[model samples]
Target: MDCIHLTGIRSYGYTGYLPEEQILGQWFEVDVKLWLDLSSSGETDAIEDTVDYRSIISLVQDSVKTSKFALVERLTASIADSILALSDRVTQVQVILSKPAAPIPDFSGKISIDIIKKR
Candidate 1:
């Protein structure tokens, strides 16, 4: 299957296990890979024959920005599910949700959840 990849999508969201995180929010990076057949689109060179990546990005941004979640796992699952809902052509999806500045004292970088789903 052909795939479209969206990487390092940055958004400010409220998704964490702490009070301050919920109130103030933080920056999150999302990476998504969507699997679909692109033969028709490639042959026809028609936008309608393939998934619209800009729309997908908008969906992800809206879903993450306006919502709050306590677990990256749930957030990833939600993203996958939402993407799946958008089109039947999407046979599989992988989502990575990363928090670059976690609240942990010892942590210097990011923590993330990665999940793959197939329909």
Candidate 2:
């Protein structure tokens, strides 16, 4: 299957376990991989034949911006499901959700969840 990779997507979200995080919100990042047949688009070179990635990016940004979930897993699942619903060409999706400013004391690393879904 042909795939499109969207990387380094960043947005602010209120999804976190801590009470302060839920109130204050924080920044998050996402990387998505979408799989589908691009041969038609490649041949036709028409806008209708290929996925309009702007819509995908908008969907992701809107999702992260308006959600208030407690776990990255839930957010990722929602994103994958929404992407599937948004486009008929998408046969599979992979979502990687990241928390760069986790509230864990004395930690300077990032946390991310990776999941794949197939239609």
Candidate 3:
């Protein structure tokens, strides 16, 4: 299988357990890996034969922005489901969601979740 990776996609959205987080929103980063067959695309050299990444990005952005989730695990699973629904070519996916500025008392960098799904 061929894989397409979209890493470090940044977006601002409301996703957290705190009230302030839901009201003020926060920045989130995501990385996605999509697995599919690329033989037709490689042979024909046509974009139509491959998964359209722009659409995938749009789907991710829309999903994160419009929905609110308290846990990154839920968000990650939602993203994986959305991607899987978008194309049958995507046989499996790996999703990562990161919160760089989480309101943790002792954390300085970020917290994130990594999830894998096979359809």
Assess every candidate by TM-score. 0.97, 0.98, 0.96
How much is 83 displaced in model 3, in angstroms? 0.3
* Candidate 2 ranges beyond 4 A from true positions: none
Local accuracy by lDDT, each model: 0.90, 0.93, 0.91
Give the C-alpha miss distance for residue 79 in model 2, angstroms: 0.6
lDDT of 1 at 7: 95
Question: Which of 2 and 3 is the better model by TM-score?
Answer: 2
Q: Candidate 3: how many backbone clashes?
A: 0
* Root-mean-square deviation per candidate: 0.8, 0.6, 0.9
For model 3, the superposed segments whose C-alpha errors exceed 4 Å read none
Give the alpha carbon lDDT tens digit for every residue of 11-87 in model 1. 89987789888899999889999999999999999989999999889888887898788887888899999999998
Worst 10 residues of 2 by lDDT: 13-22
CA-RMSD of model 2: 0.6
Cand. 2 TM to true fold: 0.98
1-119: candidate 2 lDDT, tens digit per residue: 99999999999999888888889999999999999999999999997987999999999999999999988889999999999999999999999999998999999999999989999
**Residue pairs in collision within model 3:** none
Model 3: weakest 10-residue lDDT segment is: 63-72
